[model samples]
Structure formats: C-alpha cells, structure tokens
Target chain A: MKTLSSTWKEMKKYRHSYLMIAPYYLPFLVFTVFSVLMAMGLSFSYFNVLETPRLIGWQNYINLFLQDDIFSIAMKNTFLFVAITGPASFILCFFVAWVINEMRPKVRAAITLVFYAPTLAGVSAFAIWKFVFSGSEYGLVNAFLLKAGLLMEPLTYLKDIRFILPILIVVQLWMSLGHSFLAFIAGLQTVDRKLYEAAAVDGVRNRWQELWYITLPVMRPFLLFGAVMQIAQSFGVSAVSINLLGFPTTKYAGRTIVTHLMDYGIIRYEMGYASAIATILFLMQVIFNKTVQRGLKRIGE
Target chain B: MTNRLNRSVGGTLFLLFFLGFLGIFMVIPLVFTISNAFKPLNEFYLFPPKLFVRNPTLTNFTDLKQILANFWIPFTRYLFNSLWVVVLGTGGHVLFVSLAAYPMAKHDFPGKNLLFSITVLALMFSPEVTKIPNFIIMSKLGLIDTYTSMIIPSLVFPLGLFLMKQYMEDLPDSLIESAKCEGASEYAILFRIIIPLVKPALMTIVLFNFTFVWSQTSGEMGGGYIFSEKLKTLPYVLVQITQGGFGSMQVFAWDGIVAVINFLLISIPIAVFLITQSSIVETMATSGIKD
Candidate 1:
C-alpha cells in the first residue's frame, strides 16, 4: 500500500477526477458504505430504537444460531431458495436469450418483452397469482380442479405448507428473467458472427460443440454478471413471499432470512439482532458470489 | 453456410417449442390480469373463474375513482407527488451515476480501483442488509417525511455506474484524446462528445431508474420516510385502498377494483419499458462486465 501522504498527493493531482465523482460517491459512502460498516458494528451491541446500544459481545450471533429455532428454519429455507433459484434462473436466462438471439430482430424484441414484463411489473403484479390461487371454490385453480373432478374440495395453495415453498419457487422463477436476462441478450449480440465460421472451418461439427467452444467462452463476463445478479436476488426473496403468503407464513413455512430480519428490525425494533441476521445474509451473498465468480472464470476452459 | 453449420433445423424447432411453452406461463398471468380488470363483478366470482370476461364493464374503474375520491387528501395531490419524485429521482440518478462513471471508465485516479471494487461488493448484496442503518442516517439528516429522503438515497445506484462504465470503455481513447488536443474543457467534452455517444447507456439507466422510482413512490422506499397523508403517492394510496386501508370488509366487495388498480400499477412501467426497449437492448449489447 502507498503511504498516506503519497495517496493524498495523487488525489490532489487528479483533483478534477475527484470532483466529478464526489456528487455521487459522497452520498454513496454515507448511504451504502457507512450503513454496511454500521450494521457490522451494531451486530455486536444491544440496541432497541428507544435506547443507546450497549455492547453485548457475541450474544446476538449466539442466539441466532443456537437458540432461535425460527432462525434455523429461515436459514434452511434461504439456502434452499438460493440453491434452486440462483442457478435455475442464471441458466434459464442464458438459454432463453441464446434461443431468442437467433430470431429476427423485431420478433426478438417482442419475445423479450413477453419474458421481461413480469419483472418490469415489480412485486405488485404478484397479486394476480393470489386470485389464481385463491382458497375459495371460485378461485381459478380450485374451480378448474373441481370442474374436472380432480379434487374433492378447494385448496388454499398459499396457506398449504406442502405447496407454499414450491409455489414461491415457481413464481420467483417466473420473474427471474430480469436484469441478467437483459444483460445476456446484450452480451449475446456482442459475440462476433465470424467466430462461428472460423470454428466451423476448424471442424466444429454440431451446435453444442460451437456453443461449448465459441459462445460460452465469449460470454463468460456476462455469465459472471448474471450469476451475481441471480445470487443477490435469490438470497433476498422476501417481498414476493410477504406479498403472497403473508409476512410469517403458515408455521413460518416460507420464512427466509430477510423476512426474519424484517420481523426483528421493522416490527420488534430489535436493531442489534436484525443486524446480526443482515450480516449473515451479507456474508452468504459475498461468499457465494466470490465462489461463483471463480467458477465462472473456468467456463469453457 | 455458417448458420447451417451452427444450428440444425431440428434443434431450432425444439427450441422454438420450448420457448412457446414457457411463453404461455409468462403471458397467461398478464393476460389474466388485463382480462380481469374488465370483468364485471359477477364474472369475477363466476364458477370455474373464467379467464375472459363474457360481459366487460367499466364499473371497476368507476369504483376505483369513487374510493379514491373519498380520501381526505385529493387524489391529484398523490399523482403530483408520484410524478415529481419519479422524474427527479430517475433524472438525478442517471446524471450522477454517469458523471462518476466517466472518469472511472477512462481516467487514472487514486483509489479508483478501490472504489470500483466497493461498488462490485455492494452489487453482491441486496439493499435489505443496510435498510435499518440507512433509515438511521436519513433520520439523522432530518430528511424524514420529505421528498429528499426518497430521491437522495437512490442517486448513486451501483448497477447504473457499472453499466455506464462498461459502455463508456467501449469508446476508443482516440476520440477523447483528439478532443483534449483541441483544448476542450472536461465539461464540454463530456456534454458535447461523451454524452451523445453514450445515449444508449443513458437510456438504459433512465429506463431502469424510472421503473424503480415509479414503484418506490408507492411507499416501499418512502414508507418510513413520508408519514403525512398528503405527502403520500398514487401507488401507495392505491395499495392502501386495495389492501384494506379503508376496511377489510369493504375490500371483499371490491375485488374487481383491486384487479383494476393492479393493472394500472403494472401497465405504466411496462409501457415505459416498451417505449425504451430498443435503446436498452442496444445499451446492454456492450454492457459486459470486463475485469
């Protein structure tokens, strides 16, 4: 590392560059960077909204792991979500973008919109699924099953512990083709067409061979980006869960770490405990992303 | 010849079939939401829950208007609040992110790599990790219950900066070098040369920020910040009305109105996206994250 004096001198030399970045960076430091540091620090203290934080050592972390049953369930469910949705969405996005990339430009744009509209609609659109899965006899799925004699009675899909996680997974996947998908589409367009001709001349026989040799390596950067986006999203799957199945679902069935954090931080106002949960989640994502980044570097090698 | 070598006809057909199947799942919810908005109340409760309305009516729209009219604050006030916040938030975010991104993409500055690394680190985690601390900071700044609380925090989106930097890097150094040799000011070169060249990236930023800020007006971002009734926004009010703000009992009778409001909430962003989709595609084409 450079000495502090030399670093300061360099900053002064590029003062114009510093000036350009300050408007955005200063607020970013206060809002994002400082908040992250404060959360990490607060995880070790006991602070409710009404009182000053009292240093409590590792009490929050201990309680979170050893004593809290609900936290364990939340942890399990969060891992399940990240494991399933993260890779599923990442591969699905790349595949869908690859398929559509071969279509005519006008047709491609329309098809992209079809897949992307759900994400663009944000969380509010998830309400439509409520009607489809509504518990009453008049609910779409229930009514269809009843008419078809497939079920003896109406089923409340959202409330059923057996179905809640699966349904959440499906809905999450439905909206999963979001930012990364768009990035993939853009990345696919950048792959030079001439590479395929060159590869074919080199005796590449089939589409899979071409993809393995040419496309995957060429798109590695985007694949890495898409992986990070999916990891972040799948780990933070609270809004859709809360919107669909209420905050603490049946027996906390669909409760993820984020919902658990919300339970403490927002409702109970146990800022210290919530920070511990947040720090765990933050660590999980960073570690997972680092691993994925390394793995993506080996793609097509 | 290259196309034939790269893709078999059977492979193309199979992929199309798979796409078509997935497209059904993707499109049905949207179609159901739209069709339900026009469904008469009786059709809403029909046996077997019809996907299409046999008799369409505007009663849901009229009911929404009536519910909104009964609010203590005028509906237009919420509209104005949403409009200004979205405009200012989206515009400021794009401008600030792009300004910071230019130097990081093109210049050699102290701590540049460190700042960019922090940005990548930030991108790995979601905002929930920092929500409580951000709230504390907002309260400390005396920005609570104000528009600044909403607009100011969103001005430095890392995704926008990352994308902008990537797009800007694709531009050859010679372009900027030539402009510099002519003794042009940094501001002039940025505004006259760089900005116009990077329109696709700007469009991408604008579209993403617009969708984000539009949805945020509904109290997701502003829920803790803005407490006053008059300071509330259109979507927040709509959510309140549909999710039993007036009363849960009344909401049961207004299912059609809820669908109508959901349609309105989602369509605006989708429409804005449709208008800017082409430019976004262009922007993303160069948006690869190079090390």
Candidate 2:
C-alpha cells in the first residue's frame, strides 16, 4: 500500500540499525547461515573435495537410513545416552545446586568451583580419564581392581564394548554438570527468601513441601533452560566419546550419530553423506529441544 | 526436641556425604592430573598408582621444554598464537554480540523477531553441528590453516548475543533516554554507557571465551582449524609430542612431559574461574528471574 518514497523513508529510518548489524551479521551469515545452507546443498550432491559436486538428490538420505546399518546402531546408542544422561544430570545439577545454595557464601562458592571445575578444564581434564580406563596395569581402575583381588589381569575398558558405554556415560555426566549447575545456582540465588517466609506463614510446614510449592514453581524458566541445553548436549556427544573410547569403539558400542558423521565427513571425505548426517542431527536436536520446551511450559500447573 | 535434633544431624550427614562424593568425582581427578606433573618417572609408573608424590620434581617441565626445543617452531610462538587469537577473538565476540544486541534489544526495528529467532536457532545447534559447515565454508573461503579461520568463526558465539540482548533489555529506559537527551549517539551510548553498565555480562562471556578458545586451540580436542606445525597452538604441540610417540615422547608414567602441559592447560582456566566466578554468578543474580 505504500509508495516508493515512503518505503525509502522507512528504509532511511532504520539505516542506523542496518549499519549496526551489518559488520557482525555479515560474518554470521557467511559462517553460520550461509555455511549451513551450503551444507544442506552439499547434502544433495556428491563431492570428494577434489571433484566438482554432482547432484544426487535424496539418495544420501535414503542411504543414511537404509544402507548404513551402523548409523541405525549409532542413532539408537545416541538416544540411550541422551535418555540416561539428560534427565539424570538435570535433576542432579538442580538438587546439588539447591543444596549448595544453602551453604555460607564462602563455602558455596568453593563447592561450585570444585564441581564446575571438570568442564573448565575441558579436554585436558579428560586426559585423566583415558589413564583411569587404560589397558595398562598401572591404570587407576586396573590398579584398584588388581589390589582388590578382583582380577588377575588388566581389562581393556576402552576397547571392550561392555565397559565403554557405561564409562563414557559417567564421564559425560561429570563434564556436563558445569553449565546447568552454574545456571541453577544463579537461578536459586535470584529466588527471594521472602517467598519462603510468606509460604511458611501459609502453612508450608517442611522443606519438601516448600520445594514443590515454592522453589520448583519459581524456577520453572531455569528448569526449562536446563532441560533444553542438557538435551541438546546429550544428543550431541561426540568429542568425549572420541577421546575416551577412540573414534569408533569396539563392536560400535561407543559409536554416536556424531562419530558416524565424522566417519563420513572427516574420515572418508564424503561431504554429501556427511552433510546428510549433519542435517539429521540438526533436525533431531530441533525436534527434541522443542518437545522439551513445550513439555516444561506447564510443569507447576 | 530430640526429634528436631536427630533431623538436624541427619541433614548434616547427608550434606557431608554429598560433599565427599563431589570430592571423589571432581577434586581427586584434578589433583591426580596435577600430581602427574610433579611425580618422578619411577613413581608415575608405579603399579598401584600412588595418590601422592614422594619425590616431587620439575624434570617434567624440563622434559617438556627439552622436546619443544627440538621442534622446528618455537614454543613461545605457539603460546603467542594462542594468546593473540584468544584475546582478539574474545574481544570481537563480546564487541560484535553486544553491538548487534544493543539495536535488537533497544530499538523496535523491523524484522527484530526474525533476527532474534535466527540467533536462538544458532544457539540450539551444538558447536559440533556447526563445525562441519564451518569447516566446509572455511575451505571454500580458502581460510583453512589460517588463524583468521580459527578466530573469526568463534567470534560470532550466539550465547553471547543471547545473553547480551537479555542483559541489555534489563537496562532502564530512563538511562538511555537521558543519554539521548544529552545528544549522545547510539554508538557513544553503547560503548561509553551501556557496555560499562553491563560489566558483569561482559566479564562472564569474556572469561568463558578465554577459557574455551584457550583450550580449543591448546589441543584439548583436535586442535580445530589450524594445520601447519608452526601455526599450531601450545596444546597442539603437546598433542603432536604424545601422539607422535615413545621415541621422542614417553607414554604414561614415563611421560611427565604431557603431565606438565596438561597441568598448565588445566590450571589457567581453573585459577581464572576461582578468581572471577563471583562476578559471573553475580550476573545471574538478576538474570532470567522476573518478579
């Protein structure tokens, strides 16, 4: 309904905003958005880094589900990993954070530091885990077991399927406690004590009742935030698996959807196939994240 | 009175037990890693791994130094690369996210919802999801093996934008209005006034980016993006040394060298976290909670 001059005037009005966003947004577009688009495009074409990409349509997607049985196993393992670690860490972080929040200020800060310290050290800290589960008798687990008279010989935890998944899950839970834990602690701090006092006068007799009636309801947004972040995190468990269990663990036990993607994208240089895997992971995250977001909306009610 | 006293004792016991579990899971691992750097080679290789060191020494540091001296590239060069990229990258991440955030947060500009949704989308996908496309794009731009490739992509950290916008929205309108009345431009208002006001938010993201990038390039994982041995960061040097193996670098107990490197790698972030954690938590004091 507008004429050219009016449209131009409107554009002129927002010129400053356009300028402010351009420098950063341009790089963001190139690196994040445009690259994502390129990945989607590459998903439909076969390129081996040297040849010109040839269009291959949905075959990549088809191959992902049909021909690639290892991917199905990987997908299943990822779900199990997500199912266990996601909620367990969420409740653990919240509960632990709540308890820590009750401490004197000095003690609270110190405890938070020790708990969150695992993630701050990131992969370097992961180095210790490799030794813990190493094949050598000098490895912590092996040494402990040998000294305990549990085993006559060292067990190869990383190479053996029986031990790999459980160990990876434990290590995953440890490293991930930091983010949501910190967020929960911060969320707890923001909770006003007056609410508890007010609720107490209303016949809230004990801590359990206070938590359900007061703290949980009050911290719904943080709960939602933690749920979404931890879900996305559990879904995308790649680096730690690769580090602890090696890229492709024995009998595909430690193979995650991410490792599968790496097998194609990085190892084989099958960019299109890799892109398809990436797209699937991308879609799964969006789906799971949204479902959690919707599910958490009415928790207190 | 007896029932209440018993309950108090029970609560204290539970808390103490929980703290002990945390020490076993969290503290012992780090303490063990740090202890690796100080232990004598023979002590390191001991079958029942000694929880503490008897003959603590600095030979690990010297061993790490001796190896680095053999490399074609200088160890200082790798350290420099990591420092500058992290410093510049973290600065850019904060500056860019805040700039884009200011307009998006304050103004009723067109397409604000669309723009904000894109950031939320970006945030949802884990960093690993983006690394593939980001890597592809890096090669497409011929930025592979370049520091620009490493630093530039990380500069657009979406979490910073999300947090910055959230922090900016909490700023009182009267403050910005007063500045506007005094004839300050948006740029001046942002750089001079608004950013200073959001010091806690700024400090939090700065520390995160510093810790993250310092470790990222330091070869915590795969030494993302950079390839040339000389262009490598400090941790990459550690990776090459250990990965290249026993002839030059000892494995496990005999390799106190890797321990010292990991010690340095682990300490910086932990030390920084301990020192600056209060401010980071301080930002969250009012963030995400609404009356």
Interface RMSD of each: 1.8, 3.9
TM-score of each: 0.97, 0.94
Clashing pairs in model 2? B218-B235
Task: Categorize the docking of model 2.
Answer: medium
Superposed by TM-score, candidate 2 places the C-alpha of residue B127 at a distance from the truth, in angstroms, of 2.2
The residue-by-residue lDDT of candidate 1 on B1-291, one tens digit each, is 125565688988998899899999999998888988999878877797877779989999998888778766778998999887877788888888878988998999988999999998998998889888887888888888898877875686788888888889899999999999999977787889999999989988888887777666664433557777777778877877767764222444378888898899889888888888988988887766665
* Candidate 1 local lDDT, residue A217: 96
- Candidate 2 residues lying further than 4 Å off, grouped into runs, are A1-8, B1-9, B220-223, B245-253, B286-291
Report the first chain's TM-score for all candidates: 0.98, 0.95
lDDT of 2 by residue, B202-289 (tens): 8888877777677677553444677676677766666556554423444442458767877888888888787778878876554452
The fraction of reference interface contacts (C-alpha pairs within 8 A across chains A and B) present in each candidate is 0.79, 0.54
